[model samples]
Target: MTHTRFPKAVLFDLDGTLVDSAPDFIAVINRMRAERGRDALPLAELRPVVSKGARAMLGAGFPDVAASEREAWVQEFLDLYEAELGLHGTPFDGVEAMLAALEANGTTWGIVTNKPEYLARKLLPLLGWETRCAILVGGDTLPVRKPDPLPLLHAAQAIGVVADDCIYVGDDERDIIAARAAGMPSVVALWGYRLHEDDPFAWQGDVLIHAPAELCETRAWPGTGTQA
Candidate 1:
């Protein structure tokens, strides 16, 4: 259903929706592989799983390793990635413009992501968004993360907005599921990372956008009303 009013807040997933962090992931994972004497996987092969977090990337880069070992490797990967955070990767094209437009229009925006709070916060200064982001709720900020809805709910609360007054944008199925559970409208970010086997349509977001610039268009937002 199309909303007739502009949402009070817009929430986004950090890794894929707002930032193209695959380069950092690729760099660190490749470095880890090199340490293991394994050849580095191509960027194309690793980009899709970047949003799935370190564990997924580790499994893809080291498929031969036992699942039990992956748990330990996840911490190693996160440690390495934290040290190299913001060394590569930037906001997706048009993301800054979109955010600027939102602020100019008096619409508040925040980030809710599965990335650890400290890591996600570290990116703010690099992008010059340290003072601009309305709120930030990370995976570890609460007992549950995306697909659980609590993060989304807490983000809206943190920003002093109701769930129905917020719209969530994300690249993964779990994002949409969480938005739905939180009673917030959602937009699927088609420009973000996703496996070739993934079907965005199945996520059933209120809207789908192929590029960050599209977010500037009122039609790309969930509500049907003109920009507030």
Candidate 2:
């Protein structure tokens, strides 16, 4: 699974890699809790697991609820969130500039996320990325998803790139695991959300980007080796 440096395509994890979606997530979780006569969680408490998906947020907001109640609450949170998708989310700092730079250099890029297809599809339009992203592989797009390597492999195939010619950027351990399994290079997005005790340096991705702006510096990307 080894290869030369500099990938042809860069795949991103949506929630935390490309965008900081914590505000909207916090709002939705809090709103859902309020509806159930519970106190809303503060931002500090909710931001850590924003990239972990709805279940994590639901569990954080309703830790004492019965499992059945938590399931229903999670569904309600999703429904409410769908209506407010992208309301407070935005591409991370320098993300837009970095994407534009990639486009100018003819470097293909796309999204591979554990977010559900419907939600991911809905958010793209709001962010005006409906036609800009080269490809998108949602959690449910295939029989398997991230941490399985199948979805990441699918994204590369769909974009006409070999798995080894793709670099994945993500904020979670699953992202690195998937990239390694798929034979792709990977970067750990340091600006993304994580628990207080989480360690990005130990995640062991090929690169670590502290700010989205750093990504714009393609020639000097932290651990990209030399560009191809």
Candidate lDDT values, in order: 0.88, 0.83
- Model 1: per-residue Cα lDDT at residue 213: 95
- Model 1 scores a C-alpha lDDT of 0.88
- State the weakest 10-residue window (summed lDDT) of model 2: 219-228
Listed in order, each prediction's TM-score against the native is 0.95, 0.92
Best by lDDT: 1
Output the number of the TM-score-best candidate.
Answer: 1
Which regions of candidate 2 deviate over 4 angstroms? Answer: 1-7, 222-228
**Per-residue alpha-carbon lDDT of candidate 1 for residues 37-146, written as tens digits (9 for 90 to 100):** 98988989889998898889988888889878988888888888888889889999999889987887788899999999999998899889999998999999999898
**Deviation (Å) of 196 in candidate 2:** 1.8
> RMSD to native for every prediction?
2.0, 3.0
